[model samples]
Target: MTGTAKGMIGFDWAYCRALAVGVQDGIADEDVERWLPEARKVHERILKERESGLLAFWDIIEDEKVEERVLEIAEHFKGRLVDNIVVLGIGGSALGAQALFDALVSPFYNLTTRPRFFVLDNIDPLTFSQFLDMVDLGRTVFVVISKSGTTAETLSQFLIVKERVVSLLGREALKKHFVVVTDPDKGVLRSWVRESGVLSCDIPPGLGGRFSVLSAVGLVPAALLGLDIRELREGARAMAALCETASVIENPAYCNGLYHVIADLDKGKNIHVYWAYSDSLYSFADWLRQLIAESLGKKVGEKLYGPTPVKARGVTDQHSQLQLYREGPNNKIITFIGVKSWPADVDIPPAEEESLADAGYLGGKKMGELFHAEQRATAWALAEAGRPNITLWFPQVTPYTIGQAFFLYELQTVFMGYLYGVNPFDQPGVELSKKMTYGLMGRKGFEEFVRYL
Candidate 1:
């Protein structure tokens, strides 16, 4: 599990070693050793829970029935000429799909022969209005995703899109062009699926939206875009299996979780900054932000504790934020993500033989080399300044690697929750805000909150 392709991804905390007690604000080797048993205990508890069929997300990746169902539906539409694939979702529903599509597919995929993919995660009137104007309703396929079928943003978006689809393609075309992925038997979305007779998929009962990426929530969209959905699941399955073991050293998920929790609890470094060198991974970083923020940022009893999670794109953010990161407060634990190989590369054209002789060093290097070099420099510079950092190196940015990364972080954040003594699955704080919005909007039960506000 430590090799290039065999492991798919690697985590190195060597640079963080300098943060030992005497050197700087870092967790000592002895501390990591002390926490190893604690981490192992958490792992053991998770395994026990999983063994008794108590954990859904832990085993959701290996659900063959869901995979087969998703692929069956995907295969049915595999060869259909879809000019546009509109995904109507928000939060976990939309972010994971967008992250996968951006990371594995081409940046200019829509401009090319592939079907243009758009995830309407927001309800900006002008945005959806513009989208409706740009694509022909008849040739587009609408994927309306909402586990509850009652999410305000998603339902609103589906309504708007459904109207246009019915108006343009006629009422008969709704069942053909619309695909709904929600709860299998419950929720308003499911009722609509049955009445409309449209193709539909399940979000799996007990599966939280943020953690449902590997389920049909993510696979359906990935398959629709021609990505290797099975490979993605295989990658997640591999990581999940490795995580079942009690040894943190052998399990990247455990190791990641330990370091993040240790950095926050022991090192006083409360800000977790993720620096992704690949632009394709930037959205993946966004997905990470939501996972960490919503899951770990919580209060238990009389105490409140959670680290702030931040995202930065390497080489790009190097110019914009590196100065502050280097000279400003040392309250951040940075994780630098780098790709070992890119699918494509473009070397500098020898500086045109005469331009910027001082810049000649970059002449023979590929653009990717510069990207990698800047990450290395940033890590080195940060460590020199006594800033603790770690790296999650990917052998390549493919569906397999992306899938592995997704599980790795998901488990890590969950472990962080256990360490912080909070219920990671529930977001009561966010629900309060949702209640406020519902009340403000004249929802019956939330009227009290609206009046108070």
Candidate 2:
């Protein structure tokens, strides 16, 4: 699992190839070919947009300034005895760092040599209070992230934490313990940093919060944990290059989007399930949920479209949801994500009893072995039941492989947006909710909307 493979992530669409065909439900190899030329054109156009700076997120890996700043900050905290890092931001801000920490580091990371990471992305007072008790305030570092610096949830959390730091160590101590990641020239956070002399970093202009992983938002926390940030960017940069090919068959990202859209539009398969077989990857499913849900669920003029994205864990979801997935409806397209090798494994000892003979087949088997068996069995069963499923194979789960995954999915999302004829970068529905919250909270401009309440 530790060995570094150049292209560790893979995509398999065989079960999709086995699907029932027609104008409504089947995806022949020809359908993939038919869609390739147009998808290629769209891919090329997106690259053009990147070149002109219309899409800032895609250019993150190639930005030398971002990498330099991230590395510099990482170096500052590298050998220091910083015990805990509390990251304050919701959605994109928190999920990316959480996914990286979960996938690349050990589950028992805090107890090990790695600095403990606490991502505060919610407003649960009890949970927030509990975290304060879990770590010593003086030994902890706070990374407050908000691209706009106006997100109410993030600012509220920052206020509570800032007050505690100020009271415990005085206002001057904030300079040593806190760092703000926000817009460089604007936002309340930037102003605060300027006035208080706190250290800070800028989230690249035009980069959305969800796509800020390769930017300072995600890299800061990852670098602090001793991960190879450069290698992670290299993996993403390589994947981005590979996905630029004109042939859809050669581009995994393009192919992935094509199948999902075909299944959703042609067939009645509207539920898109992202089933990851690794416990470490469960949070990654959450990250993808936001990415897919926010990016694709939109309207192109009068047409309303977008497949529902569902997150399910392997082996665990087998017991809970497999029955419905198998017998209930032919409405779901399952994407199985699995690892070829795990960092460590445990062998199941044999049952030393006469009555346990029925379960003897599992004895002396590695946990990962059984996990893969279940995955294959599930795919086989679904195929037999006339269900369509695809597999995303990961040779190993390292920072490099994860970076490849992030870029691959991001590219796939953009391709899907083109297929659906919608802008993938904006979240108008989410903004409406934000406006409502601002009105309810008595924010200045949103006061007019409060009348409805």
Candidate 3:
């Protein structure tokens, strides 16, 4: 097939090279490449396995039924005169979409135009109270998203907001006020939706919450905020095409994944520093942090290693963290993310002779030139310190670049998961805290906790 056709069909050669390099580095087995030709067979096996129901779930996500349901939710809100949308969700359900919303949408989109969007993903009482106090209940809509529909933080906030909506708009207004996006067949959320008469949408089965950004969990809020959902899909589709290929060197995802594997397996670099030059991408770092942490953190045989630690801090980190990074243990792989051209730039003219003499530096260098020089110096210093680094330079910061960047990381992460020999799609570790919190809450049933002073 032609490249475009093959890309559309999800064939990626670069990702295959990534898988191979990962294997050769002893991070995971080389058999991953052998499984490529039988990719469909492997997918079928995943669909049949009980634990692999996630595969079947994701398969149905692109189905007409799911898309139609998402559109319905969008239409329902669009039909109403809602002025605000408060999304109550936590962790995966909230973070990815929130990051995209914040990055891609104009700050003025909500304030001057359509329904303003606010995310209440935290259980902070003060923040929740402030949010409610600011929004007008008469024109506000609440979108409660929990893949399982029973997340305590979500449900608790939902209950609080529901009571307020009922009080201000009355019980009859509950239908107009609340909507749910969750698992269709299972979970207490479905039962609650049925009993409460709130509109509901399904969270696809195989797609884990973290990976559900392309699904309704993400798209619904995105659409509400006037984002181009098609572009988002096209970007993901493009990345998927990149992931399914055979040649590794040509794929950005494979190269990134291979570098990570080599850093961890060969160089014993366990920490991955994601250094972004933009302040806007700080949250993007957090999203990457979760993606890496949850995907490769499983115990394999006697070894319990996860994907290398992914930390997202700004270029400003050079002033502080750069010291330890340069002089400390050689256990980190620094990835520098830079934009080739910033939409905003300030040029500093040549300093006056007196000022130049006082500073003991060049008299005529522009401020931009000085900043670039400093960045180059830091990069050189790190290299001199024997610190391996990779630089991803973006042409500019736009939706297209952002989309491509997101997909690049996602593809690399998936390959990294495969290389680590762990189920990157599922996060069994997150349940521990949820279970603990529920046990402590004494809600509905279960054991009581004793508090010692």
What lDDT score belongs to each candidate, Candidate 1 first?
0.82, 0.84, 0.67
- lDDT tens digits, residues 264-329, model 3? 766577888877665556666777787788877887778886755655555578878999988998
lDDT-sorted candidate list, best first:
2, 1, 3
Worst 10 residues of 1 by lDDT: 18-27
| lDDT pick, better of 1 and 3 | 1
Which predicted model would earn the best lDDT?
2
Clashes of each: 1, 2, 12
- Model 2 regions lying over 4 Å from their true place: 1-6, 19-24
Tens-place lDDT digits, model 2, residues 170-246: 98889778888999888999899889987788997688888888889988888777788888988888788777776
The ten-residue window of minimal lDDT in model 2 covers 17-26
For model 3, what is the C-alpha lDDT against the true structure?
Answer: 0.67
Better of 1 and 2 by TM-score: 1
